[model samples]
Target: MTKAAGPSRRSERSRVAILRAALELCREQGFGGVTIEKIAARAGVGKPTIYRWWSSKHAVILDAFMEHIATELSFPETGDHLEDLRGWLHSVARVLAESSMGPLIAGVVGAAQYDPALAAEFHQRVYLPTRQTTIARIRRIQDEGRLPDLSPDTLADLITGPIWFRLLVAGDPPGPDYVDTVLAAVASQRFPASAGGEALQ
Candidate 1:
């Protein structure tokens, strides 16, 4: 049993080392420059070791990138759901504006245009979980009659589209007022001044 445990632990350690090395390499050199050979060399493992766990270097990079983001991201609940949603939006904007993950995410977005497998894997592994969670939250608000009767998908797009636009299209930093403006635009159809003011509480 101890002999079996020894190899299992070593494999786990090597997996972590490879992911850490991959993230650093991708950040330093970008995805085009990252390769399995380089990651294995940096991780102190052979190419076969990496291939044993992941099908390709891109898979390894995706896992590493997703892992880092998951650790840093969260949706805090303050029991007031609307306030919580606003806070969640603020937190997301802050992450993109303040973290190194932003460029990495942009790289993946660009890469996905040319790589279908990477796009699918990224959507399944990274995007869908966050999207689904946010949608469920929005559905709850809709049920409360505080929001217009939009589908959760549309609601999510309304909330996230501007944030993505600022990052990807305009290259503008997410200013402090951006979240408020977005919230107000969505809230105006029903709640009016309460969204940007104090009446909601």
Candidate 2:
């Protein structure tokens, strides 16, 4: 006899359904419209099922938002570290500029200002992983003597800060050449050394 799928599979399905529902609702009605009850109804699950997994609507929204950006969060592998970084930044800026998730992200950022718990959760779940991964790659670039002897954290900020400024403060969407321009600016400061062939660590 074939073995049946276990409870873990069911749990996984339920979790995916909940998150998918959350994303759909947030897209249709914005983050403010998402509620545990609505998500449960859309996912055809009980409210208790969502409560079992997440602490609140804010937490659920953050998880759903993380799921939405999962693909974009990976470090690209394009042979050149600066090129890879530029590509990732362009991809992220495009997402923030064109996608519906952009508004959701902005709303979350605003909400996080007043909600310390949400801010903590965002740092823990979203910011830290991406930052650490990018910083690790930057450290590898620094070790190869391509980049300056800057801290990895500082490098990450330098890379992402302008993108966020364009997205939030400047209110101007990054043009296609934005990444190339940024790369040029960084490359201008490149240390004179053999700084290639370094893979992500």
Candidate 3:
């Protein structure tokens, strides 16, 4: 069993090294400058080794980016859901404002605009999973009666859309104040129950 596990452990180590190298190169050279050759060289692996795991540069970088996000941006599940949401949003703002991951994400989003294959892969591998997770969290908060009975999907968009806009379009980093403002807006937009059922007033 130990003999069988040796190659698996080595494979896992190689995969981690490759992902880390890809992210580091992205920080140093920007996403457009990253290539399979560069990643292989930085990772101390062969081109065939990278190609064995990922089909393209975009795929490799996307996986790396996803891993980084998974490590850094988990929604906290404290009993005070509102505070948890606030903390998570603040964490996102900090990352967008202060980390190399910000520009890397912006580069991927910009590239996806013109590359259909990359866009599709991004939507499938990144956007959908993230969106689903956000919606689920919103739904849970609503169930706990801390949030309004708004559509979780719409709530998810409302919570995250401004941050993306600031990062991608406004050319500005979202700050803690911006996060607080968003939370205030969310808290203020309460849909009160009526005879006609809960409707936006």
lDDT (Cα, 0-100) at 103 in candidate 2: 72
Global lDDT of each model?
Answer: 0.79, 0.77, 0.83
Per-model C-alpha RMSD: 6.0, 5.5, 4.4
Give every collision pair in model 2: none
Task: Provide the clash count, candidate 3.
Answer: 0
- Candidate 3, TM-score vs. the true structure? 0.84
**lDDT computed for candidate 2:** 0.77
TM-score of each: 0.85, 0.80, 0.84
lDDT-based ranking: 3, 1, 2
lDDT for predicted candidate 1 compared with the true structure: 0.79
Off by over 4 Å in 3: 1-6, 190-201
Candidate 1 similarity to native, TM-score = 0.85
lDDT by residue for model 2 over 1-201, one digit each (tens)? 989889999899999999999888887887777789999999999999999999998888888888878787566897787667767877787778766867777777777888888789988888778777788778777777776765566656666777778777776767658867775666457543443334323
Residue 51, candidate 3: alpha-carbon lDDT:
91
